[model samples]
Target: MKRAFVPPADALIAFETAARHGSFTRAAEELHLTQGAISKQVRQLEDRLGVELFRRVRQRIVLTDAGRLYLHEIRGPLLDLTAATRQVMSYAGSEDVLNLAVLPTFGTRWLAPRLGDFQKRFPKAGLNISVRLQPFDFGAEPFDGAIHHGDPVWAGAIAEPLFDEEMIPVASKVFRDRHDIATPADLVKAPRLQLSTRPLAWRQWFDQAGVAADTAFQGSRFDQFGMMSEAAINHLGAALLPKFFVRHELAAGRLIRLFDISIAQRSAYYFVYPENRTLRPVVSTFRNWLLEEARTERTDPETMLPS
Candidate 1:
């Protein structure tokens, strides 16, 4: 029988942090401990395990072969332990927090307002929202749940669709004043705001609308929809924006749809969680509530309109 193995949780934490960051100083900062303390704990772990975990490079630390092997052995368990502890603690508290990763625009305009009902029903369930850009990788990140738009085939996760997102061409009132975009030919003369790396948006929209323009519709490109929306609102150029993200702007007349043409995006928002994670009581509770909300959104019919 292998000797029963045991290590202090704190020491394991220190080792895991140091290994992940490759820096005792960074581990110390994260753990709120002195560098000497972190270093000592790591050294002790190595001594007890009878392995040289790391080598002292000129100034930086490099994982020794032993250290690399140990990290591979221990990293998964440590991360799982941390995640389980957090989920349990969240359940134990009066504030039931659901850490959600969402698209910035949709979280603000679509989900945030409606969350009030979720709070009312489960008053204890508090929501903590974080932003995730498109093409997010859930594997490497420490997110409990994510709302994104894409194919639902994330490596080891399950996706629940919220709704299909449609985009419409929009611009500030001021932009229309300066340009003659009465027709698609005229639109070519104006600037086209680009959002992220979605390359086929302009061509697809124009093609669907039975119109075409200078294939090189040019303007400033933005990595986030929020930035592109701002640029459009500021009279910079035309942006194909999702109605759900800018319902307020459209309702308040801050933005005007240049045309009623809407395109069904190949992707839509989804709520995804890792299939392998141990679902704690809190995680289950939050997941149940989110599914309920998605169902409500689907049936309400009225929610489909730009509010």
Candidate 2:
């Protein structure tokens, strides 16, 4: 007969809390227990595990080498357990919820406007959105799917093509008028706004325009398109922005196209989900709806402006 291995849940919890806070008093306050009680629980856990988990340093406590390793190993599982419990509780009286990770700017500026139609189409299905700045492990996180930008190269997920992006040089009217950028060569003189992710954007743009500008590498770098657009609008510099993202600003005359030329991005946006995980009905419905929406947007004359 094989013996079952189970540690004391209460003691483990107490130890984890004390290790995290680095003080039994703080952990006890958080757990709503007496400091002595927390210390006793941790001592019991350490005895059972046959290892010292913490080092008493004056009035404070710090994790030992074994303690740090144990914390690292248990944190993910603890988070998963909590998320799973909350998910079950949430679904007790409601429809199935689909958790999706999306880019902050893209979700706000583009997807947010179309959510009403999605809700109308699937009134019974619930949607949850979280901002995801970069690629992450789908297995570790509780996301059903994600809206990802760049290449379809997520290690464990299936990447479905959303749309390709076309970027163009844009600047505020004030900046454009001040610089008098009549040609691509003249654009080299203006301050260039760079995106941190696309370090080679300016260099590529200059190459495509058949202009040599050593200053392409020098400029204010931003992590998000919204920030870069705002800077451009404030007359900070000229920015290379996706046409769709800046369509509203361009129409409102807040920004001006410095030239008619556009650079087609190599990588397109994608809808990604783990290949090993089963696709729920709600997630499938959302995927289908999103793809159709993208198709409609692509074919619409108003949405597809002339380059």
Candidate 1 Cα deviation (angstroms), residue 85? 9.7
Highest TM-score model number:
2
Q: Which portions of model 2 miss their true places by more than 4 Å? A: 1-5, 55-69, 87-93, 130-143, 151-159, 203-218, 251-254, 273-279, 300-307
| lDDT assessment of candidate 2 | 0.86
Candidate 1 local Cα displacement, residue 122, angstroms:
0.8
Among all windows of ten consecutive residues in candidate 2, which has the lowest summed lDDT? 298-307
Cα lDDT, all candidates: 0.78, 0.86
lDDT value, candidate 1, whole model: 0.78
| Candidate 2 residue-wise lDDT, 1-307, digit = tens | 3223456778878888888889999999999999999999999888877899999999989899999999998878778777778766766544788899999877987799999999898888887788998899998888999999999999899999888777889989899779887789988878989999888888989999999999988899998899999999999999999877898898888888888777878988899999998899999999999899878766655323223
Clashing pairs in 1: none
Clashes of 2: 0
Superposition error at 120 for model 2 (Å): 2.9
